[model samples]
Target: MGDTGMPRAFIPRPSPCAPPSPISVFATIDSPPWTLAMSTYGYENCVAGTFYGFTKTEFNPGDTFSLQWGAIDDGATPLNITLGRAGGYIIDEIIVGAQFTKTSALYQLVVDDTANCTLEEFSWAIPDDFNTTDPQYQIGLFNASVLLGADGVPLFGWQAWNPDFYVRPVSSTTTTDASSTTSTVAATATGGNTTTTTSATSLSTFSASPTSSSVSDDSTSNSETIGIGVGVGVGVAALAAVLLGAFYLRRRRKKAQTPSQGLGGVRQQYIQELPATEKRPPMHELAG
Candidate 1:
């Protein structure tokens, strides 16, 4: 061991490279099915050639690049960018911001997480322009499978379905009022008294009177006719009774007179026939 604590060997410090600047991708969703706005921030870095097992590869500039939210086999169009490629490359440095812009499409999105599950999975589609007035630019992602990164991990956490816009009334109110009024004219005899009340309001008006006299008259011609009919019925019944009594009396007189008359005639005939025999057949006279 050299002299205790004799200034340790001077180790030259390594120079630090500048950290990569964060990139931002702004996205706004104006469509019906989705309404989302976000800014994705990230950094770009070049991978080592040895990592790809290719020693002769060269980086190419001015080539096309794309960053998709879903897996390569998901059948979704990748969010793309046009760039130049220089030479051969494995993983090129295409700086992507941490934030991204997104918006909804016209058609609604319905995502199901589990088969037959009532809970619905939520998703949003992105449009090219945020200020586009035409609704056609809206991109709709319906029942889309969750997006996955190269590492096979979900890009975003779980999200619930929600509407983008809201509606409100211009004005509203609630109030009510009702009232009424009354007028009366009265001419009364010596101790008569009368009173009236009236009220008026925006909704309605009312009026009342303590006393009122209004009569309707109907003629009694029908009653007079009915009385005449009753009188005629009584007269007819009396006439029928008198006629029946006369007939009964005549019949009784005829029956009683006939008996007496018949008896008288028979007696007369018998006396006329028995006169001679009666003179000779006087028994007491003959025996004397």
Candidate 2:
């Protein structure tokens, strides 16, 4: 396919062991198709600051892949290839030729004859953290001269404005124990009498993962419910019995508190003792 605009310029790192460019992480996305075009030697139709022949876009963590440069026409000289976050490199800063070949102590790649070259594959052990948060990755092709501290060298690498590939998002279900253990050594000595005390506290805090409920769990729950219900019923029955006993005792006490009727009364007792036919004499007859 024709070039989809020009690739961006990439600045060479100061040192060989320089870190990949600091890139803000983004969610994983599907990769786009490769659009690098290349030509043969002498009349090499190669463009400056642009990588030519890489195809695959997305890769799984720890997978290996090959990076292709169409044709350099620079035979037997080593090249510098780097992978990092894209959109931040300058292309014109990389200089190629015999003087720049294999200048750095670091090794990027070796090409015996660029004109009759075969693309060699490279493997990147993608780290565990290269997931949903940070997916963008890119590669660059450069000459070893980019590493030297020349007085007036303004060359850059051939790279793209966007990332070349991505790492697929991995589900984060199996996170490791986030807690670290620490040991504090203690010693107590009293005239050669020594003791060691270990008061280590371990705290394991993680989300309570849901587990499949078994029959025993259901049975325990049901048993607890049944026991509570039976206890409440027994408590209510005991309360009722206590209230009935109190009511009966109160009635007996009330009856005992009442005075005896007519037995302790003198007129009523005399009238009851006299016969029913007996009558009292008149006052005049009594006087005569």
Candidate 3:
């Protein structure tokens, strides 16, 4: 995709009454259609919505980025599966990560393990034909894929579509003339926890840590820039220990609720989108 602007993402936040906790960009592991979540103040259950968590709000077509999350499957294992179909949709553009796999018109990613709840990340490349100029045309994943199947066909509750995502408007005089685009994104801090550094590069920068997400057209390579602050010190021992205790405490809240039946027995998920306009999100205090 040509330079439209930096890709943007959005996500949900914890309640104000919640305590200071490690923040993470994660997808919930539940029934077929899972939800994306992030924790800032404290731990909470997933909230279904028109838009889930994202570091940026709008992503430029061809912009490659990652979606990482920690989810526990108290309901059933989230297996990544794709149906034999004709063409590709927005969700099909996924390059596939971890449990993720894709065909021409279909893809599936189950970042969450069958049980362990830590972090798993993957990179996604938006196709050039994608809609970036219109929010109505903005693609949605997870909760909003009700009316879509592989290749945008009619499916009940699979990774069919996306929402609240957009493409940035290119400054006509600027984008075409420049060989590379340099843009600075301002960060919005909530509860004084999330902090993001504003930077820019020629290609476009996308990275994820335990804490927050920052996008800059600022890095030379997208893969090289990921996990920038994710230190090596978070050894398996530490993560395993923390997850053990955190798992039990969080597992009690793991019951799943099927989305109410829509017309023709299709599972339709009604959602209330939480504000994710804030730029970077912090990992849990323990994540540090």
Index of the highest-lDDT prediction = 2
TM-score-based ranking, best first? Answer: 2, 3, 1
Q: RMSD per prediction, one decimal? A: 29.0, 17.4, 48.6
Alpha-carbon deviation at 265 in model 3, angstroms: 99
In candidate 3, position 260 carries an lDDT of 31
Deviation in Å, model 2, residue 101 alpha carbon: 12
lDDT of each: 0.27, 0.43, 0.35
lDDT of 2 by residue, 1-288 (tens): 223234444343545565333121222112222211122334233443334345567666655444434334332333455445655333232112311122321112323345444222223345455444666766655455335323333334332332367766544321221221122122222232333222222111212222334556888999999999999999999999999999999999888766565346866778799877867875665564
**Clash count in backbone of candidate 3:** 34
Q: How many backbone clashes does candidate 1 have?
A: 40
Compare candidates 1 and 3 on TM-score and give the better one: 3
Candidate 1 structure quality by residue, lDDT tens digits, 1-288: 111211121212112242222222333223343332111112112111101111222111221111222211222222211111112111211112111223223112122233211111122222233222321211111111222121232212111111112111212111111111122122222123332211122213322221221111123566677899999999999999999999999999999999999999999999999756434644465564
Ranking by lDDT: 2, 3, 1
Distance from true position, residue 29, model 1, in Å?
A: 35
Question: Where is model 2 more than 4 Å wrong at Cα?
Answer: 1-12, 15-56, 74-77, 86-117, 147-155, 159-163, 172-288
* Model 1 CA lDDT for position 47: 18
Looking at candidate 2, the ten consecutive residues that score lowest on lDDT are 198-207
